[model samples]
Every structure is written in structure tokens, then in C-alpha cells.
Target: MKEKLARNINIYRKEKGLTQEELAQILGVSFQAVSKWENAQTMPDIALLPQLSRTLEVSIDKLLGYASQDRPITIYEEAYLTQDYYWGTEPNQACYQVLQRMPPTKPIKLLDIGCGEGKDAVFFARNGYEVTAFDVSDAGIEKTKRLADQIGVHVNVFKADILDYRLDQQFDVIFSSGVLHYIKPEFRQEIFDNYKQFTNPNGIHFLNVFVNKPFIAPPPEKEPNAYKWHSGELLAHYQDWFIQESSEIVFDCNSSGIPHKHAMTSLIAQKMTSLDH
Candidate 1:
């Protein structure tokens, strides 16, 4: 495993056109450490694996010499199996606001990542938008299909992981709420970059992430399913985009029926038209 990881690190770093020194600088490690890793003399710390894989644009499984397959299916499957509407049946407030402001003349293309039970996807579809919704859970996709059927709305639903899902078409609006935080911090930037590239000119992205806060309690040690973003992290990533709205708020977990305080950063930004393009 060590030798395989060493070879992969070398291959991926070279593929990115980064030298040992460059990769070390990006990872905030010494060049010698990078050299040692590639030489198979040592391995990166467990915590550094996520960042390393992200920098290489590879999955953790692939970086660790495991066969690249579907991401672990247990997490979302458990959620769907245990709860019908894990996040409730209504569109979130952020999504609802975006839907209300959508243009009426043209049919807008919308993609809902982590669509969960499909409430938001169906809501947009019913509102006359062409919607494509996807989740990692089979049950979630089925629930989405059922919801669309019940509402007499059409939504193209599929099962996919956000990390590896390929986007063949651009969208006018991309909505992802309470989902980005679940991604490893290193991979979040790649996801954001993909969303930006997949958005049409002047297209908007509605995103929200859990942010670190003093008052917010950490997820239980045994259930570390999500990562808390640093304050202003989302803004830092989208600094060049046209920010339509941005805010930080603390709210109770009404959807989960859990009386816990949650700190979140919500943002709506539009891709800017490039003059060179």
C-alpha cells in the first residue's frame, strides 16, 4: 500500500505539473517530506490524505491504491431507510427565494445537488424549471421520483456522488444546501470550481455550508460525517463572482426535530461574463 500510494502521489503530482517543492508548499509541508513520500520512505499523516487526494484530483480510495468504485453507500442509505423526509417535504427557505426570483419567459435549467427526498427538486419542476436532481442514495432517488410522480411534475433524477458526478450540461441555477460541508475540506474547492464552470454566464449558484462557531457543538466523535467550514471560507472561494446575497445565521434543527443550534453560511452568487470569451 505504501509503495502504491507513493507511486500514485508521484503520478498525480506530475500530472498536475507540480514538483515536490511546489506540492509541499501547497500542502504546507517540507519539500523533503514530499520527496520522502514519493520515495516510499514514509507516508503522509492520515489527516493529510484528504488534502493530498484533493490536490491530485483523485478519490481517497484511488490515492490509497484501492479500486476506484462507487463511494461508500451506507451513509445516505441509512438516512433514507430510517426517515421518509429526513429534511422535511418543503423547499428550504434559500431555495424558495431563488425559485421566486427565476425569470418567467425562458425555461431555466436547474440542478439540485444532494436533492435528498426531492422536495426542492419537485418544487422547482412544478414552478416551470427544467430540473435535474441527484443524490447518492437509491432510496433518495426513488423518493424523488415518487414525489415528482405525485405532483405530476417532471424531474430527471439520478443516483450520483457529488465528488465524481460528471456535468454534461450547463445550468442557469445550481442549488446545494447543507451538503458542501459534508465534503472533505480539500475537495470542497474542486466541487465549487466545477459548479462555477458548469454554470452559464450570469447563472446563479445557491449554496450553504456549516461554519465553525463557538456556540455550535461538534458532531459526536463517533459520527463525524461533516466538516465545519472556517468563517468567511465560502466568500474567499467566490470572491471573483458576483455575490447576490451572503449571510451567516444560527438556527435550530427544525427539520431533524433536534433542538440543536447550527451555524451556517448561505450564499447566492452569479457567474460573471468574461470579456475574453
Candidate 2:
């Protein structure tokens, strides 16, 4: 939460054209104090939260890194409330790629982004990887925890929005499936940069994004914020990274009880600082 607060303060302050000194002056605190907050070294006083929120033009909840208590952002919330898992109890096939490549021979920290129902997150945990997972839905988080408990493995799962959640710790493997479209195009670079920065050296990221295709029609779910990626768009952002594998495929889906086809681009990228690995 401290990391979220710091990131939000910096982002909102910049959006409002305020520097550290200016924001400090408005909050009646030292510029050093404002800098400290943005650096995640310290936090603002509780009394100043309202004022800070007002000045930033964002709610206190947002400043503290909480998604707004507004309407449901994800349709799966209701579906997940059912007795069965919405997506299914099976881990994605991409999970096997990570397991085979990294093998968890040593302690490997893995993060399952948008871990719907905990299938993949629990899979990683059961494979001896320290796993953390998050999704935007409360029901999904509950299901994730329940699945992990039923499997006798622990997954540190919580609720998080991909747009607002920033990693404060490093991970060896970062995996996400069918969630990158939630990120607006303009914010993609910044978000990916943060993810890359927080990754350990030689860390791997396996991600798949729904791509816009001339032949393939859109899915049944009309999520409000989803923006389909252009073919190879995900790779353009990782030109500097070692692209271990990449492929584009068209697959059938029965989500929402409506059969449809989706074109997706999947990439396995590795971070490297030097040629000698």
C-alpha cells in the first residue's frame, strides 16, 4: 500500500503540473517530506489525506492505491459467485512452459497477474514456487484462496486492478493470460516498464493478449475498458528484451455460453542486461 500511495502521489502530482515543492507548499509540508512520500520513504500525516486528495483531484482511496468503490468493473464477479469456477480449475497451458523452463529447482518467486479462480496461481504454489496472485473481483480472490486451501498450498492472493497496481517487489516469473487488454494503449509502455524494472535479472514474463484480427470476431463479453491489441503489438514493447518465444493463434472459446473465436498473441520474454547469461 505504501508503494501504491507513493506511485499515485507522483502520478497525480505530475498530472496536475505540480512539482515536489509546489505540492508541499499546497499541503503545508516541507518539500523534503513530499519527496520522501513520492520515494516511498515515508507517508503523509493522516490529517492531510483529505487535503492531499482534494489537491490531486483524486479520492483518498485512489491516493492510497484502492480501486474506486464504483460499479463492477468485471463481469466475472457474478459468475465467480457460483459454486463452480468460472474459468475452470485447470491451469493455463502456458503454466507448463514456465515450469519446464524455470523448473523451480531453487526458490523462485512468481506472480500470477489477474489470477482468476486461482487455478494457475495454485499450480505454481504446488510446483514449489512462491506465488502471489491478484484479481479485481472479490469473489475471484475468495475462489483463489479457497482453491489453494483445498489443494493444500498457499497463494498470496488479493484484489488488484492491473492499471493501478504496481509491483513493490521483484519476481522471477511473471505470468498473465487474457488480461492485458484491460490496459489502455497509452498506459502500456509505462506499465510494462514498471513490470520489467521490478523483475529479477533474467526473469521471464509469459503473457498473452487478445489481438485484433480481420477474420476473427470479438468475444461475447463486451468489457467496457478492453482494447484489443494489434497483431505483434505486444512484441513491439519488448524490443530490448530477449524474446524466447512468440506466436499468434486463433482459438475457440465458450465463455458466457456463447461460442466465439479469439486471435491471441502470446510471448515469452526474458530480461537480460548482458549477453553472458
Candidate 3:
């Protein structure tokens, strides 16, 4: 993992306004030890994990680079955390709000990146849309398939990295909620470029992602949260293929039930009828 553990730890520490020297003193370690840990040359021993976590003001799971949950639920916190309440309470309503608004005269073929737990997939498939779902986690893909089978719905599930995955088929709509924000900013433009190729004529794309608005704060940290985004920064990335249809930014909770009183932005854009890929 290229020693992301250390990198994550450093991110948390800096966010907490603690320097290596300061944190070292608190942990009863030399500044050099803290530096090595930050540099990924070494790791804190398991015995000191609890102390380290408390001193860092992060949960042990966060200190260890795992999800906040007791069990390592998903590799990424946003994956399941974003979906739990939405799925448990009003999954179909959530999907319908996005999908039904489209002009229904045409058949809809949909592609979902990071389709965790198949909540949205089930909603779409049951409503007679052809859906192709992708997730990087095998466990997620298995759960999607099982859910589809259980509901007597048909869906094609692919367990693959979204960054490397490509499709020969195009779709009338490509909807990825809580997935686009997870993409690192540098690669975001390239990722959107790929989406352009995936969209059929007159197709629409929907996205729900984090927005940077310091005035609207996020929930208390339970772990090393690696990414932050401003809505303006993220929208600039999609200007080429997405013309804003409808968008709203609101206070929302993150996947872990953390109070994310930040601007959660959602947009619906119709793909330009003609764009030479």
C-alpha cells in the first residue's frame, strides 16, 4: 500500500494542529521515532496503539488506517457510511429521485461505479432499467449479486478498479453517487474524460460528492480522513461533458453517521448531444 498508513497518520496530525515534536512528547517517544512513523520507515507497536490513538485524538481504527467500525467493513469509509442511512430508510426513493426525472421516452442503460450493497442497483433494475454495476471490492460485488438474485432482478456486476476499467458499451445514463468525490483531484479530469466516452447520446450523469465550504463543517474525525473538496473545484473538472441540469448542496451525514454539516453537492447534467470522443 506504499506505506499509506504513515501518510494517513500525518494527515490527521496536521489537521489536529500537532507537530511531530509536540506529538512525540505526548507519546513519550523521540521526535525521530515520530518522523520515521510519518515517513513509513516503521510503525508503532500494537501495545502502544491505544495510547497513540488517544494522544492523536483519533480512534484506534483511524490510527491503524482502518474504518471506524469494529470490523473492517469496507476499505473506504465513504463507501458504506454514505449508503447505510439512505439505504435503510429510503433507497428506492433516493434512486427514483435521480432516475425518474430523466425523459422516459428512451430506454435507459445505467452504469454505477462503487455500487456498494446494490441498494441503488436494486432500485433501478426493479424499475426496468438495464444496469451495469462496478465496485473495486469483491465483497461488495458479491453482496450486489446476492441482492439482485434475492430480489429477482438482473444486473451485471464487475469487480474492478474504476480508474482502470473501460466499457465497450455506452449508456443512456451514468450515475455514481458518493464515488466521484473519492477520486483524487489530479486524476479527476481523466476520469471524467472516460465518462464522456461511456455516455450515449442525450444521456445524463448524476454525481453526489463532497464540497469544500469551511463555513459548513464536517463531522468529528474518527479516522484519518484523506480527502477534502470544494464544490467549485470539483465542478471545474466536469465542465467539458457535464452541463449542469439541477444541483443542490446541503448538510448531510457521512457514511459513518458522522454529522457532516457541510455542503453535500449533487448535480444532474445532460451529456451534450454531440461530443467527438
Candidate 4:
């Protein structure tokens, strides 16, 4: 908790474009105090939490690494509120890959990050994997629950911002699609490290990101939070892991009722142990 709080403080402070001294001034604390809090050497007094939360524009629970019951933070929340699933009920092709490569011969644990409307997560759960999924949109989480309940499968779905959420438990497989771009380039290392650290050895991560290309125009759904990855940039983080499949593709889209194209890169990597030869 201390570590998460410290990291969140630093992240939010930077995101607000404030230096240590600047934030300290706003909170009426010495710059060293803020630094110590961010370094995990000290924690702010309980009384200061409210003020700190307001200043950072974050909820107190979030500052302490808990998922606050705040309203949805996703641009697709409106679309998801409708009865129809915004992204549809069909699971991504990567879901099939995970099923084949790491079938739940045992009670395999899997995580679906940013599982918009729960289709992929539900698919995994129905196929016998123990699945936990989360997204930043309340509607999305609710839709996921509805899907699982309707299918008679269980999926532990909740609302969480991918940028602030960290894995605290080990999982056998981690899956994400069309969501990595929500993480800014600067915070990718720390977030990815957390993901990799909490993954059991031999765990698999099937992730895809929209890559910025000169030829392909951006999609019609111009999301403010979206940050396109550089071509081959996603592969750099998995140098130590075995890359089973790494490729890029140009795809068509009509999400916003306007035709456009997007380039995306996908990677399927498996964690390796030092003993693996």
C-alpha cells in the first residue's frame, strides 16, 4: 500500500505538471515532506488526505491504491451504457491463442486487462479458466457481469483505470487488447514491470497496441487518453521473455461511423525461468 501510494503521488503530481516544490506549496508542506512521501520513507498525516486528494484531482481510495467507486473514466462509457455491447460479444483472436497455448488443464488463472464489455473475459471463464477482469468504465464492468451471469460463467470484473491499477497477485496468463495505448509511454516501464513481476513463471501475456504509422490515418474515435505506440516499441519490453508471435498489421475500422485505418502490433510472450535452457 505504501509503495502504491507513493507511486500514485508521483504519477499524479507529474501528470498535473507540478514539481515537488510546487505540489508542496499547494499542500502547505515542505518539499522534503512530499519527497519523502513519494519515496515511501514517510506518509502524510491522515488529516491531510482529503486536501491531498483534492489537490491531486484523485480520490482518496485511489491514492491509497484502492479502486474508488468514482464514475466511469472512459470515453466509451456513454456508448457502453446502451443495451448493445460497444465492442461486440465476439472475443478477440488472441483469446483463441491463449486457450490453445495455455489450456486450463489445471485451474489456470487469467487476467483480462481493459476488458471492454467483458466478452473476452467471459470467453475465458466459459472455457474453464479462472478469470478476473477490469475496465475503467462502470458500464463496461456492468456489461461484463451481465454477460457472465447470462452465460452461467463467473468473471470477477470491476472498474479500474489501467494507468493506476497494478497486479498484486500472480496469474498464469495476462491478456489485453486495444488498451495498452491508454498507458502513456513514460509510465510503460513501471506498469509493465508490475505486470511482469506479478506473473508466475511460464505465464503468458497476450497484448496489442495501436501503433502510429505515417500511412494509416487515425481512427474516427479520437480518444484523448489514447497514445499510439511506435512500431516495434511493444517488443522492447519483452526482450527477456520468449516471443512466440510478434507482428504488425494494418486494419480497417468504422467505430465512429467514419471509415479509417489503424496499424496495430500484437505480441504473445511467455515468461522464462533462469533454469530454462
Q: What TM-score, over all chains together, does every model reach?
A: 0.72, 0.85, 0.62, 0.92
lDDT of each residue in 59-134, candidate 3, tens digit only: 7655654434343333553454443333442363447755566744556788877787777877788777888998
As for lDDT, the candidate ahead, 1 or 3, is: 1
Model 1, backbone clash pairs (residues 3+ apart or across chains), number = 0
Candidate closest to the true structure, highest lDDT: 4
The residue pairs that clash in candidate 4, if any, are none
Cα deviation of 144, candidate 4, in Å: 0.6
TM-score preference between candidates 2 and 3, better one: 2
lDDT of 1 by residue, 159-222 (tens): 7666445466799999987777666666667667877888899889888888889877864322
Runs of candidate 4 exceeding 4 Å displacement: 17-22, 66-72
lDDT of each: 0.80, 0.90, 0.67, 0.91
- Using TM-score as the measure, which candidate wins? 4
Q: What lDDT is obtained when candidate 1 is compared to the true structure?
A: 0.80
lDDT of 4: 0.91
**Residue lDDT tens for model 4, 141-169:** 89999999999999999878898898889
What TM-score, to 2 decimals, does candidate 2 have? Answer: 0.85
**Global CA lDDT computed for model 2:** 0.90
How much is 16 displaced in model 3, in angstroms? 28
Encode model 2's per-residue lDDT on 114-181: one tens digit a residue: 99889999999999999999999888999999998999999999888887888889999999999999
Candidate 1 lands at a TM-score of: 0.72
